[model samples]
Target: MDNEDKKQDIKDDENKEQNIEKEIDNNKISDEDKKNTEKDNIDSSKNTSSKSSLETKERDWFFEPKKDGSPSTVPSDVENVIKNHSTYFLGDTSEKVIYLTFDEGYENGYTGKILDVLKANNIKAAFFVVTPYIKTNKDLIKRMVDEGHLVCNHSVHHPSMAQVALKSKEKFKEEFTGVEEIFKEVTGKEMPKFFRPPMGKYSELSLAYTKELGYKTIFWSFAYNDWNVDKQPDPESAKKRIVDKAHNGAIYLLHAVSKTNTEILDSVIKELKAKGFRFASLEELK
Candidate 1:
């Protein structure tokens, strides 16, 4: 009777050990499955992020010109990028307003007259200056600041910022900080946190970096081929083109080097003012 009881008890203990081993194996399998699932999810997320990064390629700012005095039409994707990066090309369309911006790559002997016209009109505009321009034209830059105009960064070497940004974020930042350092040295004031990509060339990455650097990227709604100094457009025709293209929330990109722009700026301002379009500073942009 004692031997049989001992054998039965031994059998029961072995069964219990087998059951415990099974449970342990099941738990190991469960843990492995969970880890595998998590790895898959992480890999999937990384793939999606990589695809999104690939999609954010370089893009040039463009708009459809309309002579009906309506707001110009920009591509929906372009508009989305601008908004996503907190950038601006157009202002509040509900109000008739014009934001005048001049790109000064270099002094072409027209900036002073342009300044005189601006002073006479009591209109404050934004001047996007390059590092070279700021270095060479300190007085003009100072005048811009003194006159309540916004002196903004155009870049260090005025290359396509998208290219710079894609290469390295530090380099992209240097493009802005370079101008900022010089301008601060010249004007003794902090440069405005506004930027216009050189030649209106930019990309989503560039815009993102710009926003990270605490700058608002500015594009233009209306621009003509007035940058070529060798062949400036006729002032009368240029003025007609400018006034005809005047729409609500228009951001006009004029070359400060353009003699035609300097010649016709006063008339264009008066005409636009008469049409109930108030000139506004970028700071007033909604």
Candidate 2:
């Protein structure tokens, strides 16, 4: 072979070696991509399993599978308990804060408007709701959650929490858990850690049982005789009573069904604001 022929043969050998190296690099890249895909699938599976476990826990503790029934009207003895002794539910804080709560044993057509006023004033509150309210007013409940308000359990049948005799601890638990179940079923969210005993009637036994079930019984410091549809207090007087009682760490109880309450709420907010009190959710006080 001549010199030119020998040089051409050397060039062909170098080009073959370069092609082999390129093929090997591409194979390695393909193997790495396969490994990455497998790892991603594993991560996705683990995430799905973890989410399923969380949902199961939430469902077991907080929601019923189906709606039970309508909530009964507020009982008279329960009203008396509410009228006589609701002072201890007020938290002992010195800040210029007032906690707002609305009872939903029955809807008398004012809850949405009440929620509107609260939204307009940039305030959040706690709504202690029964089963019907949970099942029927899902939109309002959704709004409450979306708007950063708290929804707590009031009881299944709207029985007074305090009026339960010492012997009926199991009954107390049932009512409390029943409402919690409805809230979970409707909203797929856990009920608030706070609770408002129906009619503000909680006995020592009732309170202990609720605590065991993981709840804090919230009571209001300021409330008017607003539940009476027959003798609803005038709006201005109701506003005056609420404004005068506004103070730091005060919990105000107002019925969502009160027309007088709806009319006076704006002025009440203004007066409370003017008095240097700020409205807050129950969680903030905690």
Instruction: Please tell me which predicted candidate would have the highest lDDT against the true structure.
Output: 1
lDDT of candidate 2 over 144-229, digit per residue (tens): 88888999888888765655534366876788778778888777898887877666555544555666778776766666789987
- List lDDT for all candidates, in order: 0.90, 0.72
| TM-score per candidate, chains pooled | 0.88, 0.66
List runs of model 2 lying over 4 Å from the truth.
1-88, 162-169
For TM-score, the strongest prediction is 1
Candidate 1 lDDT over residue span 56-163, tens digit each: 577778898876789898888777667778688888889899999999999988998999999999999999999999999989989889999999999999999888
Q: Give candidate 2's error at residue 86 in angstroms.
A: 14
Candidate 1 C-alpha error for residue 48, in Å: 7.2
Clashes of 1: 0
